[model samples]
Target: MHQDFPESRLQQLLPELIAFRRDLHAHPETAFQERRTAAKIAEWLGRLPGMTLRTGVAETGIVATLAADKPGPCLAFRTDMDALPMEDRCGQPHASTHPGVAHACGHDGHVACLLGAATLMAAEPERLAGPVRFLFQPAEEGGGGARVMIEQGALEDPRPVAIFGLHGWPSLPAGTVGLRSGPVMASTDNIDLTVHGRGAHAAYPNRGVDPIVAAAHIVTALQTVVSRHRDPLEPAVVTIGSFHAGTARNIIPDTAELHGTLRTLSEKQRRASRAAIRQVVEQTAAAFGARAELQLEEGYPVNVNDPGIKAYVERVAVEQLGRERVVDGIPVSMGGEDFAYYVQQVPGCFWRLGVAPADGSPGVESLHNACFDFNDEAIGTGVRVHCGVAWSWTRKGQLC
Candidate 1:
């Protein structure tokens, strides 16, 4: 840890932080509809003196800025404030109060950690050499909130030289942090395909071209994009999650619609997979005596971490939590993150903070699971790491 980190003050503040996290978890919101969540965050940050608060940015997003008497380069930390549309099966008292909405992805804990950092930093303004911006982003679950916030100038007017963010990982034990250099997450693309064919009665043998048959062939052929078209070493996924066809068995439907997602780690691979999919769908449909239409909806790009920033974060984590708790060169994940948008505009690093059970126990639930909850024991560790990085950067300057 940096010599200036106030360990005693952090211990004193941990209880309130945990309670705040639980409260957010109990009353969860999803996507751009985080009005209550934003209000709660704003209320908490408003208590601290000398903090500039901006509300309603990008609709249900908030940005809080804190500066010191001394002048230096500004740094930013972002926390997502959206929940998933799933049931809360954790069975805890602080579990979700809303039906079909839960904080299963740990965004609540993220908000608490950022708030804790802001509180501690606010108390010791003399220690800061520059301003620190806290971004409360909304709609990270497929809503593209980060892109909208950037368009509205969340990164401007004392723009940060570098930004940082973190997500809770259940695979690692508490107090440990995972760091990787490049391509930490994959790019996401939504695919919608419609196979068109002639409709006819069941008794008529040659009256109609059955699109269901063509759609089935298309689904089977799409796998070839990943298995044969792309290199075996490269990672890619082509899943047809939804398939809809005729309502009754006796009638041949005119069309069949298929919806799915495509994931790739590199832009080159993304392009190759897309082309392969289109070719397979078109040719397969033509062979079945039917026509098809394909549409691709682009999503978040691959999240690439800045090498220098990753190194800086690793150094800070090792100092604060010891070398044993810091895991370097963790494998890249196929999951997607909107934080990728922020890094495209400025140098940034997004890492994983361990959140599994502190005790050595079995049956740890993975993220996005209904029973998964953010472990409170990891909040202090996250706060310490975030504060360490922000303080070290503001005082010592950029590493790269």
Candidate 2:
């Protein structure tokens, strides 16, 4: 089906792409510490015929550029370089060699696909009518690396008119591409609360205030922030993930600590939820004769897809993988992506590339699971899609 020049060449490079992904899997690095990964990616990009490389961005990010003879708008393709801080349990031959670190999120495959696309594009530079920028960002897991990269000038010099990126999805079958318009992913915010109270013996609750009891009430009341305070139609989540208190069975600690995250699809909802959380925590703790402190950290913004850009990507997907392989109306996710930063600055579309196993296959796992492994077959799918999007925009001077 892929008879075009770059697609044909990209298909031939699947084995190499798989190898590159496995190597990244073996030596996974997390967040801003992708020094080795950055070096290797830079080395590979250096071999691309006309690409000029820039390194040491956002600590360990890389940016490469390629130009075509004809005139057109510059386009950018981005992929994350960091891995998760977790042990690999997949036990594959190329399983992570780094202890307590793994590419559980398929960032390894992302790099491979982008690399494969760059390789194909580099093989025939004349096909592109304008410049192309390859962005290898670090710390996408939670460090907001895209924001850092943008601050460090990833979008300057030859600013991109449009950009595109993808994440692997195990929910869809191997050959499908998932697309959606509007808020595709939620914004993430973190919460840290500490409740202070007088220490008391477990047997003599009347003598001193019990922070544990206050913490329990606080947690129970926090749930109401979503159930009663927020509108049912709006999507928001308030989860108290960690709670710590009490040193021994007989003694109630003077303070209880809580950690959690907030997710919302819109700024208005985010503000409302924050207000509700503070009110519930403080009031519930005060009712228990305790004082509470809450610290909220703002995280990545909600990932919104430009409608026109989303439609353009959909057309490109159909052209690359056929109408049967392209999907629409895929449900939105609560997960957060820092790619929101890039698209917030330029017109961009971020979509999903299916990596699910065929029927009856074992070892299929979701993102961030210790047993998760990037399906090699998805590498070619992603490469084809990336090449298709790039080709469509560069050659035709418009995506759709």
Candidate 3:
């Protein structure tokens, strides 16, 4: 017999969830290269009753639908499936076996949690008032998987009325959940630039235009785009993370390459910043007697949370997990999430689940860190939260 509530059943299935997370963590896959990961997910999810599986969407993504006994609008629970291109330093027995690829962003835990919720819902489909969709997305690490999935019709055939997603956070203690109202994350845009000039011996610098010098000046000048060009009150970041030039100390290279990222909170600001950056790069290079080329690779848009939906999720979280474990009005982040695309299509709420251990066992293994690993204990918390949100939403009908 199933437990009276979802939390008890999630706790009972904690061992299985932990095993699934560890397996996924050990066999890491990055971006659209999640074939093995997708297969494993499909295998586990296929066991549930009333589940209809769709594979190969967006190359290596999976969408599983579970029908309810009664008819109503569908809801979605989404999680990423891709790992990062980084080494695992956690040294756990289940640490990534695939060198240079690891689940540093806690995506393994996210997948396990969503699957656990699916299991609970499947155990007693009669409890569900409507159908639910499980989105096992791929390529979240700078690949725009959600946008690709949308383009490929991941949301069609049984489009959900609203969706929910969660990320694991190290800043908060385990069992706690964080929420915010609007603009939860920033937009991401990448910049590629090349400065062209004449090459000559360093000792005879006067004989040729120095692209290195032009690139240096350009980098320094781009700093002003965030400071003087954009409104200080609005959040924006311009960082030149990579620069390459000069083969030898004695030679002034003919071309220098620069790579960076631009992050902003709004579309208008994003466009304005791109224009300003292009203007600064070309003009700055010209001032140094060099030519410049700039390519702005557009990325995920700002992630905005619907207030009414967020409030409803906040209430569900508070009810499932005690008030002490729920944090409202959490600070907005500058990071980007492809889930922004899904919410852009439907009203959705993406929140944070705390996975930090109390003993500080693996001190500060933050997201994207090579040494990072998901806290297994938090798996149950995540599972319960997702299950609670799904059951509450399906039973109560549309909250807002």
Q: How far is candidate 2 from the true structure (C-alpha RMSD, Å)?
A: 1.5
List the candidate 1 regions with Cα displacement exceeding 4 Å.
1-3, 68-70, 394-400
Provide the global lDDT of candidate 3 against the true structure. Answer: 0.89
How far residue 89's Cα lies from its native spot in candidate 1, in Å, is 1.0
Ranking by lDDT: 1, 2, 3
* Per-residue lDDT over 1-400 for candidate 3, one digit per residue giving the tens place of the 0 to 100 score: 1134655666679898899899999999999999999999999889998998989989999988898334877888899999999899988999999999999999999999898889988897776668888999999999999999889887877778888999999998788999998899999999999999999989999999999999999999999999999988888999999999989989988999999999998888999999999999999999999999889999999999989889888888777778888999999999999999998999999999998985656564889998889988787778777777777775456532
User: lDDT: which is higher, 1 or 3?
Assistant: 1
Q: Each candidate's root-mean-square deviation in Å? A: 1.6, 1.5, 2.1
Candidate of highest lDDT = 1
Query: CA shift at 260, candidate 2, in angstroms?
Result: 0.6
Q: Please report, in order, the local distance difference test score of every candidate based on alpha carbons.
A: 0.91, 0.90, 0.89
Model 2: per-residue Cα lDDT over 127-148, one tens digit each: 6768899999999999999999
Question: Clashing pairs in model 2?
Answer: none
How well does each candidate superpose onto the true structure, as a TM-score? 0.96, 0.97, 0.96
Question: Candidate 3, clashing residue pairs?
Answer: none
